[model samples]
Target: MEEPIRILYVINALEVGGTEGQLAELISGIEKERFSPYVCCLRTIKDKSSYSLDCPIIALGVSRLMSLQTLIGMLSLVRYLNHNRIAIVQTFFIEGTILGVVAAKLAKSVSAIVVSKRDLGFMLTKRVIWQLKLIYHFADRFLANSKNVKDYLIKKEGVNRGRIDVIYNGIDIEALEKKMQEVSGADIRSREGIPEHVSIVGICANLNRKVKRVDLFLMAAAIVCKYLKDVFFVIIGEGCLKKSLLDLSEHLKIDLKTRFVGSQVNPIPFIRMFSVGVISSDSEGFSNSIMEYMGCGVPVVATDVGGNRELVEDGVTGLLVPCGDAEKMAEAIQVFLDQPAFRKKAGEEGKKVLLERFAKNKMIRDHEFYYASLTKEKRMAFKKKRGKFSA
Candidate 1:
């Protein structure tokens, strides 16, 4: 039997964000018979217990990007790649992409280098863009989570369209459904002191980035409060902007109606309680939050930016509003709040779409095919080069 091809996934951290969650799911679900998976985190793992993976995880303990530690980490990565004869090096986030791509190139043994693009370059600066462009040619492939992101790469970064592949993010429907079955929304609400009769409008997003535009979610909640007094707003996830966002909620006079529940390991219960789930991001690659919402059979109100339009079928599965328009978002949310039948129908449609289009099995299969094809191409080219040398 042929040995499993070894693949290394490099990322900044193994925390509870969209990228980290997707990486965890992918590595966990990937068929071990065909591919062996490993993870290398650029930063130290603060809580090792948070991630329960079957593969080995190596942390470089890197603190600063331009320090001796980072230099040492890069060298260690190259040594590790060569020592393991890594066939594929897949990287996530900016730091991991910059470091992993270059290190994999230096390793010489690495057959393929894949860089993942999950966002619309909303946080990228001019210098960062230049830095990324410098190493773009070194990568074998660019994996985009959404078609919108692929377009952004081709248009903004001037990447060759042929070099990019779009694979939508997937969720483990069975696992999520099982958890939803185990945890009741009423129990969660009771624990949080929320009334059973009050409608819950919730959002699950990190408060660390302004791109998420959680502030808009709050503003819209304030608007929803004027007409629906029985509505309660729930904000899931934690970040640096939590304090400021708390102040903003208070300033909007929706503080009493809002609950800022910090970073949940499993937000399925809170999601289960939501009458409507919202994504107020100024931009997104593809929304894991929207998928989670749909998996729980909850309707969504999202900004029509990035891959949101792809996930949300406007007026069918959910409503799509203009980005940065809090009033428009509030109006969409109100539509769901007023009509329970339409909301339920939309939620059902969302679940059907999610099951059909974004299953974890489909994602894993797509990746396996992509990786196997790339590895084969590399081997063929190498064999041709060896024949030339012998001749």
Candidate 2:
């Protein structure tokens, strides 16, 4: 029998977010013959149902912060690694990253623990800094979602630059395009009560202060309404700040055009109906929504932050503007809306970038290769050290 590759993946929770979605894509895409995968969730599932995946998923129910329950959950994860003999341990987000790496060491099943950094400055903090440093000391490697994130880790936390590798979050282009093409956005708009003739501006954000600036999205929409007629704004995803955003939009006097089209079974339906997808985020690592919009053949007018520039080539693919500059954001979106030819050109160009750079298959293959390399290196070193000790 051939030796199967066993991978233990730890994530905070497999909720509806970019990092979680990326994990789903990778696990589904991996060649199961060469690799066997298992997952450990740091917290309980909100839905109270087992998640369906190609690999088995374990939930530790680590609900509290710095508690005995959390420690016990970490130990349970450690025991699983020991029992399964997990070779390479990979983690996502901050809290999981800290616990997973340390537990992997305790289990003695982890040769190389890889941490995927999602955001730079905001994601890291002084509270977790010591834990991160401890993980850094014991872990074999650190993998960043992008070069920008690697720069952040090195500059902010003083992580060893040589140990860090940059791997972009992989996007599934064919699936995204097919999903978009099969959608009936016309009916979706009708059901959402948005008229067909109105200019629709879409935002894929949960109203929040730290990440997606729902406030900025509303403000930009207010300015866009001044010049454009029959404009309607669509905000997707649900968050704590949803009600506050609606109130502010009403205060701006564009409440008529504002529609709080909350979370959907399929956001692609709403995403395709719009003339353009609006991103007014103050921070991002790599934007899945921005790429998803482009994949749907819709141009984006996003704030110039994180990997937004890597996806949106200002004026070519779609316009990029300074963060919080509502006037410039409105100007760019208006320009795309005014010129039909420009809209066509920008959308097509953006799609080209997604196909070439963000293909999901490429992302999967890179991880497969990385896993092989790390495992192979560990085995070789193990044999060498054993031989020396015996002699």
Candidate 3:
């Protein structure tokens, strides 16, 4: 049997964030016949013992973000990549992209390095922007989860368009469906005190008011509840804004119609129960939640910002409203509430989009093919150079 291409996935941490969760899914879904995967984390603040990973997840144990120990951690990463004979080093998010690219460049045995840009610098600091501007020059290729992120890198950061690949985020639809079956949707709705006939619109996001705009969701929900008596809103996930979001709901006098589920480890069941999946973010990269919602056969209503437009076609799979416009959002939700047949058709179409365009297997195949192609190009170039030297 031929040896599989060895690939190493590097990230800042293995916590419960978008990038970390996506990394886990990618490693699990990659074609085992063609690729052997390994994971390395700059830090492991969360419980690493809990996540079920196929490959070994090694932690470098760096305590600080930018310190002498961090430099040592990068050196250690270089040594590990060389020792493992890793054909490709793929780094995710900001810190990993910075540290991992530098380590790959410095490593003797490794040359191919890919960095994933998952966001549009929405939360970037000046120092981080400066570091990325310097470090990204050393990377071989960049992968953006959405065209929005890809364009942002080109127009804002001045990255070469040719060097960046736009690969939409994929979801494990089968796995999601299985998880949904494991938990009864009726049980969940009952626990939340949502009646079977009532329409449930939900937003599954971190309760970050500034970026995710949970407050905007509440404002929209208040508008929605006033006219649509049978509608309820659920905000899934936990963040610092939970208290303030609840307070805002009370202030708007829609507290009776709003329920904060607080961080759910398994949000798929809740998503499956949604009459409409909503994204009220001021900014986003390609949203995994939107994909999950569509996979569960739920229509989406997302803000027309970042990659939301890429995932949702207006009036097709779901609706799109202007960012921070609660009135517009409420108007969209009301359309779904008033027309059940139309909502069901949109949900079906959304599921079809997820299956055809953003399946987990498609993502793994694209990644495997891209990685193999990069390594082959590098090897062929090296061979040509050797032939020239011999002549």
Local distance difference test values of all predictions, in order: 0.93, 0.83, 0.87
Error of 3 at 69 (Å): 1.3
| Between candidates 2 and 3, the lDDT winner | 3
lDDT of 3 by residue, 238-265 (tens): 9888888889999999898888998878
Candidates in descending lDDT order:
1, 3, 2
**What does the lDDT read for residue 340 in candidate 1?**
99
Error of 1 at 305 (Å): 0.8
Cα error, residue 137 of model 3, in Å, equals 1.3
lDDT of 3: 0.87
For model 2, residues 170-195, the per-residue Cα lDDT tens digits are: 77776665777566877777777888
Worst lDDT run of 10 residues, candidate 1, spans 178-187
Error of 3 at 308 (Å): 1.3
Candidate ranking under TM-score, highest first, comes to 1, 3, 2
